[model samples]
Every structure is written in structure tokens, then in C-alpha cells.
Target: MQTLEGMIAPKFSLKNEVGEIISLDNFAGKKYVVLYFYPKDSTTSCTTEACDFRDSHEAFTALNAVILGVSADDEKAHTKFIKKYGLPFSLLIDDTHEVSEAYGVWRLKKMFGKEFMGIERSTFLIDPTGTVIKEWRKIKVGGHVEEALDTLKKL
Candidate 1:
């Protein structure tokens, strides 16, 4: 993946669960963004990571940050996952993987001894001015949200 710090985050306009347009620009000039890329929705690790973020959403908001999740899943799938998990934040559907490639999170992975292309769980914190303040790649779900929150506070 490319180093994105000190660089402007790639702007994208994608559909959310309700098919509403959600753009990287939407939160610009107003709030910090927690732009996260995950392999899929509702998977064990993804679920844990998302729930952790959801649980700590108030703290994130208090820090003037908004969480936005991204995956190759479509709007329908995102809706199902959000409903099933009660995810508080919007899940952006990146069906074409354009945004994923721009962020450099889509990569080759080996799981169960099988190689495949997938998203590497990663999070990027973009400041209000659109510059990336921090990024966490190949994230482990445990205590990760708190760490991200702490980073946001510092920013």
C-alpha cells in the first residue's frame, strides 16, 4: 500500500446503504473522517472491528470525527449488514473497488493457505482539510478503535 500521510485523501462519491450518495467531500471542512477499508461486511473480524467503532462512536463524535466504512459490497449487502449489526455509521459501497485501489488497501492475501485478492483491513484518519493525519494498516480488531480514537484526539 502507498504511504498516504501528508497527502490529500482521494475523493470519492459512493452509495450508502439507502442508496444515498456519500462522498468524501461531504465531511470535508466540517469533521475529521475515519475512512476504513474492510474485506467484507459481517465477517467475524470485520464485525468485531465495526462494533468496536460503533460502540465508541460517541467518543469519536466528541472529537469531531465521523466514521465511514468502505468495502466492495453493494448497497443491498451493506444495508443487510448494517441492519443485522445495528452499525451506527454509514457504510459506503465500493462495488467497483476504485476507491479501494486509490487508498491502496486492496491487495493479495493468503487465508486458509489459499491466495486471493482482498481488502487489507485498514483505517485512515483524514483531517478537516482533507489531508491524512494517520493511518493504520492490517489492523487487528482488539483495542483498535480506542487507538484510533486516541489518534483522532491528538489531531
Candidate 2:
């Protein structure tokens, strides 16, 4: 896993769920970011995690933070996933896994004895200055929003 704290996050310009190009520079000088990398959209664990962030959208807004979910899935899939779950935040389509690799969440995994490259669920808290302040790798879905919010509140 990449250690992100105190380091500059790699910049990215990716398609969001609405098929709009959302770039890291778009958030600069505007909002802090809760940038989360999840395995896939609409999966059980991913759904729970997305919903948690959705439920806390108001709180995040209050803190001037925008939540962005990223996955290897494409924009259409992300759009469907967002509509299905009423996800309040933007979901970035990392089709090439470039951003995932930059964040070091894309990894080799084994499931049912089949090994493949997949995203390791993770979250990064980026301050308004665009520096990473906190990072959670191999994240547990339960109560994760609270944990992230707690750190944001302190900031």
C-alpha cells in the first residue's frame, strides 16, 4: 500500500457518474475531498460503504468536503450504481486503473483460488491544500464513514 499522508496526490481527470469529466483540479481551491477507492460499484460491501457516505453527505458538505468514489468500472456502470443507490457523491470511472495504481489500491487478490488484479478498498482524506492528510487501506465497511468524519471534523 502507498503511504499518502503528507504527499501530493496524483492528479486525475476521470469521467463521473453523470458522464462529466471531473478532475482533481476541479476541487482545488474549493473543497477538501474524501476520495475513496472501492472494488466495484453496487456490490454488497461497496453499496454499504457508498450508502454510509451518502447518509453523511450533509455533514461532509458542512465541512466543505466532497466525497468521490472511484472504481475500475466505467461511467455507465457508475451512473447506474449511483441511481440505484441514490448515492449523493460523484463516482469516478477509473477504467484504466491509472488512478487506482497511483493510489496503490489496485492489487493482486485470490478468491475461490483464482488470483486476479482487483481494487483494495481504501480511503484518502485530502485537505483543501491538496495534500493527503489521512489514508485507510484494506478498509472495513462498517462505521467507516464515522471514522473518516471524525478525522475531517478535527481538521
Candidate 3:
């Protein structure tokens, strides 16, 4: 994967669960963007990660951060997942995998001895200036939200 730290995040405008267009520029000078890419919605790991973020939503908001989850899932799926989990943030649809490819999170993977293309669970912390300040690739879900919060605290 390519390094994105210290570089301006690739621009993207995707529809959220409510079909509202959300662009990288929307938060450009206001909030730090936590752009996380997961393989799918409603899966085991994805649910955990999303819940973790949901549980810490206020903490992130206090620090001027906005969490935006991305996946190839459609709006209906995203809407269901968010409502089921009471997620306070937006889940963007990247149904074409265009944003995933730009972020270098779309890749070939092997599961059950079969290879396929999918998202590698990853997170990018983009500051209000739009520069990616930190990134975690192929990440474990446990304690990740806290880690991201801690990084923001240190900043």
C-alpha cells in the first residue's frame, strides 16, 4: 500500500446512508476526518469497529473529529447497519470502489484459500487541513477507537 501520511487525502464525494453527498471538502477546515474503510457492513469485525466508534462518538466530537466509514455496500445496507447500531456518524457508500482504490485500501486477499479483491480494514486520520496525519492498515478492531482518540489528544 502507498503511504498517505503527511499527504493531502485524495478527494472524494460519496453518498451517505441518507443519500446526501459528502465530500472531503465538507470538513476541510472544520473537523478532523477519520476515514475508515472496512470490508463490509454488518460483519463481525465491521460491527465491532463501528460500535467502538459509536461508543466513543462524543469523545471524537469533543476533539473536533468526524468519523466516516466507507465500504462498497449500498445505501440500504448502510442505513440498516447504522440504525441497528445507533451509529452517530455517517457511513459513506463507495459502491464502485473508486474511493477505496484511491485510498489504496482495495486489494487482493486470500480467504479460505481463495483469492479475491476487497477492502483491507484501514483507517486514515486526516487533519482539518486535509493532510493525512496518521494511518493504520490491516488493523485489529480492539482498542482501535481509543488509540485514534489518543492520537487526537496528542495532537
Candidate 4:
């Protein structure tokens, strides 16, 4: 809930779309990690954001950054979403919501006068050293990828 910038990122190992386990340590000292937490897969905003990342995948790779999406979606759903959108990045499955809690993105949200617990849609930019360098909480999908990309450019 507080600023994670300059702090060591929360270490995690979760299953990706293909059922491969992925850990934050995997990117440490290798590439900057763009770990983004979304609400769900195949939803309108999520799909648009994922597609945006897909479109700019090359630029991020060229900058030595790996984009990882996280949500409570299961492996099957993630795989389908990736296949449908042709996502070029790994989408970590946070089925237990532990990772979201660690990152402080899991909180009470209201929609249509109904309150419920869900992800707030956040993104953390972790440098190769595993320190969180930049973060955006309660993110709006529009122009968000560009904002994240620009921040990485500064680093």
C-alpha cells in the first residue's frame, strides 16, 4: 500500500500460462522485470492492455525488460487468453492471491454499488537488481503502457 520504489521487490514463483513455474529470481541480475497485476483475463480493459503490451513487446525486449502479467486466472484461462491475443509475454497465475497481497494490490473495490475484494491493477518496474524502481497503482489502461515504457527509458 506504500511506495515500493527503491525497496526490494517481493519474491515470488508462480505458474505461467504453460504451467511452467516462474520466479522473480529468474530475472534478477538479468533483465528488468515489468510485473503487472490485472483483474482478469479476456476482460475489455485487460485485453486492451495486454494487446498494447503485445504490440510493444519488441521495444521492451530490446530494452532488456521482461513483461509478466499476474491475476487469479487459472492456467487454462491464461493459456487461452494468450493464444487468443497472441501475447508474447508470460502471464503468471496468482490463483491463491498470495502474490497480489504481497504486492499490496489486493483490496476492496466497488462496482455497480457492490463491494468486493479484487486486484487494483498495478504495475511494478523492477530493475535487474530486484529493486522496485517505479510503480503505478489503480492504473488506467489508456496510454498506460506508454507511460511504463517511458519510465523504463529513463532508467
Candidate 5:
């Protein structure tokens, strides 16, 4: 896998829960981006992570940071997930997994004794200048949002 810290984040444009086109360029020079890639929508761990981010949304916004969740799930799934969880931030549709691939989060994995390709839980913190300042891969959901928030506070 390639290291992303201290490097420019890969650019991407994809539909959000509302079917609105969202791009990395949209937040450039405006806010720090917490770009997170997860395995699926509405799954246990995914939901926990999303809700954690949602609960901390205001804090992140106050710090000039925007949270964006990405998954291979489509817009409909994202919409349901967002509405069900009352998520304030956008959940992006990464149907092609291209964005995931660029971020080095898409990979081969094993579950239930079977091997498959999927997204590895990951997060990237990108500064307003578009450079990735920190990255977390294969992350556990517990306390993850707080960790990200702490990192942003020190920035």
C-alpha cells in the first residue's frame, strides 16, 4: 500500500445521499476533510462509525472540518442510511470503488473463511490545502471519531 500522509489527496467526484454531485475540489481551501471509506452501508460497524461521526458533526464543523463517508453502496442505500441515522454529513456513493482504490482502502480480505475484495475501514484527514495530514487504516470503531477530533484540535 502507498503512504498518503503529507501527500496531496487523490481527487474524486461522486454522488451523495441526495444524489447531488460532490467532489474533493468542493472542499479544497474551505475546510479540512475527514474522508472515510467503509465496507458497506447500514452494517453494524459501519452504522456505529457513521453515528459517531454524526454525533461529533458539530464539533468538526466548528473546527472547519467536514466529514464525508464513502462506500461502494449506491445513492439509495446511502440515503436510507443517512435518514435512519440522522447523519448531518454527506455519505458519498463510490459505486466503482475507484475512490477507494485511489485511497488504498480497497483490498482483498477474508471473512467467514472466504476471501473477497472489499473496503478496509480507513480514514484520511486532509487539510484545506488538499494535502493528507493523517490517515487511519483497518481502524476500530471504538473511540475512532474522538481520535480524529483530537487530531483536528491539535492542527
Candidate 6:
């Protein structure tokens, strides 16, 4: 697992579900960020994780943290997912996997004896200065958002 704590985060520019561009530079020197990369939208684990963050969105915002979700899913899928779950944060599109590759979350995987390429669920907590304060790779959904929130409290 790659731990980027105390390092400058890899910069990325991706369109959100609304087709508006969002980038690392947008948050730099403004607010801390909870940047999470999930494998897909509306799936079991992914939904759970997204909703967890949704449930705690106000808490994060209160701490001057911005929540952003990333996946290979396109704008249409993200739109549906956001509507279905009432996701309060932005979901960025990484259809080309560029941002995922930059974050090292793009990887190989095996399921039921089948090998495939996909994203490894991960999260990064970037401070206002674009420094990675904490990262969770191959994250388990349970309590993960709260943990991220707790980490932000320290910042």
C-alpha cells in the first residue's frame, strides 16, 4: 500500500458530475479536502462508502474540509448515483483513469478466479497547502468516513 502522508499530493483536473472542472489547485490554500476514490458507483461497497460520507458532509464542511469522490464512471452514472443517494458532495469523473493512475489507485484485481484491472478503494486527506496529511488504501467502508473526519479534526 502506498502511504503519501507528508508528501505533496498528485495534481489532477477532472470534470465533476455536472461537467464542471475540479482540480487540486482549486482547493489549494483554501480548504482541506477529503478526496476519495472508489471502484464504481451504486455498487454495494461503493454506495455504502459514498453514503457514509454523505451522512457526515456537514461535519466535514464545518471543519473547513471539502469532500470529493472520484471514479471511472461518467457524468450520467454519477448523476443517477447522486440523485439516488442524495450525495451532497461532488463526484469527479476519471473515465480515462488518469487521476486514479496518478494516485496509484488504479490496479489489478482478481475475483472468483477472474483477473481484471480496476481501482483500489482509497482516500486521501489533503491539507489547505496541497500536502497529503493522511491516506487510507484499500479502505474498508465501516466507520471510514468518521475516521477521516477524526483525522481532519487534528488538522
Better of 1 and 6 by TM-score: 6
Question: On a 0 to 100 scale, what is the lDDT of residue 49 in model 6?
Answer: 98
Worst 10 residues of 5 by lDDT: 74-83
Tens-digit per-residue lDDT, 1-155, candidate 3: 66999999999999999999999999989999999999999999999999999999999999999999999999999999999999999999998999999999999999999999999999999999999999999999999989999999999
Q: Tens-digit lDDT track for model 5 on 1-155?
A: 97899999999999998889999999988999999999999999999999999999999999999999999998889989988999999999888888999999989999999999999999999999999999999999999999999999999
Candidate 6 per-residue lDDT, tens place, 1-155, comes to 55789999999999999999999999889999899999999999999999999999999999999999999999999999999999999999999999999889999989999999999999999999999989999899999999999988886
Output the better candidate (1/3) by lDDT.
Answer: 3
TM-score of each: 0.96, 0.97, 0.98, 0.99, 0.98, 0.98
- Give per-residue CA lDDT, model 4, range 1-155, as digits (tens): 68999999999999998889999999888999999999999999999999999999999999999999999999999999999999999999998999999999999999999999999999999999999999999999999999999999887
lDDT of 2 at 127: 82
Report the lDDT of model 1 for residue 110: 97
Model 5 TM-score is 0.98
Worst 10 residues of 1 by lDDT: 146-155
lDDT of each: 0.91, 0.91, 0.95, 0.95, 0.95, 0.94
Candidate 2: regions farther than 4 A off: none
- Candidate 4: regions farther than 4 A off: none
Which 10-residue window of candidate 3 scores lowest in summed lDDT?
1-10
Which pairs of residues have clashing backbones in candidate 5?
A: none
